[model samples]
Target: MGGFGPLETAGPVLVWTVVLTFVFLECALIIGLFLPGDSMLITAGVVLASQVSGEVHVWALSVGTMIAAIAGNQVGYVIGQRTGHHLVARKNGKYINTRNLTRVAELLHRHGFMAVLVARWIPWVRTLCPAVAGAAGMDHRKYTIASSIGAIIWAPVLLLIGYYAGSFLENVSWLMPAVIGTLIVGLVLGTIVGVRQYRAEMARPAEDFDLDEAEQEPVADSPWRRA
Candidate 1:
């Protein structure tokens, strides 16, 4: 708690709220494009490691963060399943662009479960992948299995890194600033890369959009499409 004096004294409830809300919303909604979930998780880990507050348990934080991430993705998937195509149809002034949705759909078709697993580490993709999987009519079982694996791997690894760093730097006041600075720089860079990828995806031609199997053959399978 050397240089993290104030953080050590900070209330656990506030910390929990900040961490959980950011992680949850970042996964559950398109707002994740702008939010820095990685940074938040790492910061939470550091704070907990610094023992800034005894009330914050590393296990609890890790588990809670994982749950929030998984739950958020589930919500996003459901939203995509229910209203994805409608949103695409009305994509005139919506935040969810049809082009990007189509691009995501294509990725899902190409990579299947792998897309969900890998996207968990890629900022904007992580938020959009689940929705795309749903909209593409990917098997729910496959999506859930892949998403759960990704969440389990992603949350704990970062949190542990921060926890270890915090423990190592607990006595070194000067090193804390360097760690904090590095995290800030990483967050900025990640956001820039994520935004660029998103823009690139949105710029893809409409012709490249992937239609569902039923959509590809509408009249022949109208009942199947509705089902």
Candidate 2:
């Protein structure tokens, strides 16, 4: 019932709103690093499976969330383009601090399109990769293709998992309690891990990003951006 609970009574519109909003925020422009993107997708499916007539069917949910995720990443890419590479220097943010940004940069540098495509499977990396790729001057077309593929793979799998599993577990007495308990445990563990990582990351001074290379060639001129 964290956010999706009360929506049961409110009907599918509000539920769609919540799901799509989070789908966008986590995968796209909002940089909601701490959001439970994976769990949410899975749970959304699972919940729909058990519901009598509420929430969108799994296929629709999958497609809608995929669109939201792709759109979100595209927006994030534009934000990165506008913000440029200096976004890596941003610090003191709750989650968008320098450390996380730098990590995204390194990952992008190491893998290029591969990173953007697969980042969908990783939580924090997925949140920041589009922006990082944009800031780093990855080609918009390639980023779009990669991000779209990522969204396609990411959304439906999780939603379907919850949907089909929920359908099967619908008759079980322990489903609700088990799910609630699992969510609670996951939340606590995620909090603890996030806090520890935050402290450690913040402890280090911000690293100087390579500004000279970026300034040497603008987006239009850079072959990397055209790739």
Candidate 3:
């Protein structure tokens, strides 16, 4: 009852939609990086695998995910070129804060394309790398090429892992719940650790800013003051 309803239960079209959305969001932002995208892909593959009696093409979902991921990275790169620096300046901007941007900038300066490629798997860094690429003024052509290769490899590999796992776990229906449960647990743990680390990082002095508290002080009872 809590599963995908009719619109998303259709054949290739529905599966394609799911794959595309998952990849796009996963590559587009840090929040998506922690989503159960990997698990969902595997579940889709396993479910679709047995239904391959005729019209469905399992690889279609995999290919669709790759396309979405690559496109997302490109979008992120363009956004970074335009706003990576500004994001750090925005109030309450926790995701793309100054420290993260500085770290990404250093990586881009040092490693260039290799940095983007390697960051494809690291959840926090994945979303930031493409934007950092643009901020570093890397050649658009090179960025596109490197990002395309990385996305193609990263997206398919994750889906394939899920596909293979689904195949192996086919006869054991009981294991499905266990796998999903374990993934949820892992996600919770990762989130807790990530949040703690982020808080700790943010708690450190903003070395670059000596913001004047008097000029920007909020009124009494204001939300900003409360914060």
Candidate 4:
């Protein structure tokens, strides 16, 4: 058995680096809108389970990914909090359309903390929701709690799926290609769905969303609202 030659040669260091970097960036930056962090996580899980690159502990990988995801969300939240205020104050700009911002605020307000948790499972939303929460003045403490919960659930679940798949295929080496092909198909379909959803959301009229001043008020006891 030759094993997974590419993964074997890449080694643990490279695997860890790639997974952590993609995970962090996918949560923290706008670039994450296009990055397939979930796929990477699943791939990492497969690599570890297959034992192609020495003994890579599943727990260690999960923990590292969880930390990176949580921290990345924090960074994105801060960026949104700071930039959102300025965008609102300015009223108009090429990138900061007040109408869109208002809609985002309304969405965040209506969903509250639940959005943070749900968004984690979503692709583009996972990267954008933290910033949206911050922009909407969601209590920071609540955001943190929700994001933490989401990250905890999201990271391990995807990793485990990949790990299990790899483990099952370890002995059936010939099936590796089929399994990978299936994953690719799934990813493509998922991306198409996510993009369509995003576009639909963006196309909705801003007037459809409305919020009262009281609802927008920042909570003093929690970092839930600051806008």
Q: TM-scores across all candidates?
A: 0.73, 0.74, 0.66, 0.72
Q: Which residue pairs clash in candidate 3?
A: none
lDDT (Cα, tens digit) per residue for candidate 3, span 131-157 = 666644556777787788888888777
Off by over 4 Å in 3: 1-13, 29-34, 53-56, 89-95, 173-227
Clashes of 1: 1
> Could you arrange the candidates by TM-score from highest to lowest?
2, 1, 4, 3
lDDT computed for candidate 2: 0.69
Q: Quantify all predictions' global Cα lDDT against the true fold.
A: 0.69, 0.69, 0.59, 0.68
RMSD of each: 6.0, 5.4, 11.4, 6.0
Local accuracy of candidate 2 as per-residue lDDT tens digits, 1-227: 22235535565555466678878988765435766678767766665654556345678877899899989998888887777666654346655666666667766666667878778888888888877777777778877888898899888888787777766666675666477357646745764675576566556566445433433323333325532
lDDT of 4 by residue, 106-220 (tens): 5566676776787788776787677767655667888899899999999888888888877888778788656655665665576576556545544544322222332454433
Which one is best on TM-score? Answer: 2
Clashing pairs in 4: 138-224, 139-223, 139-224, 139-225, 140-223, 140-224
Candidate 4 — which residues are off by over 4 angstroms? 52-56, 86-104, 177-227
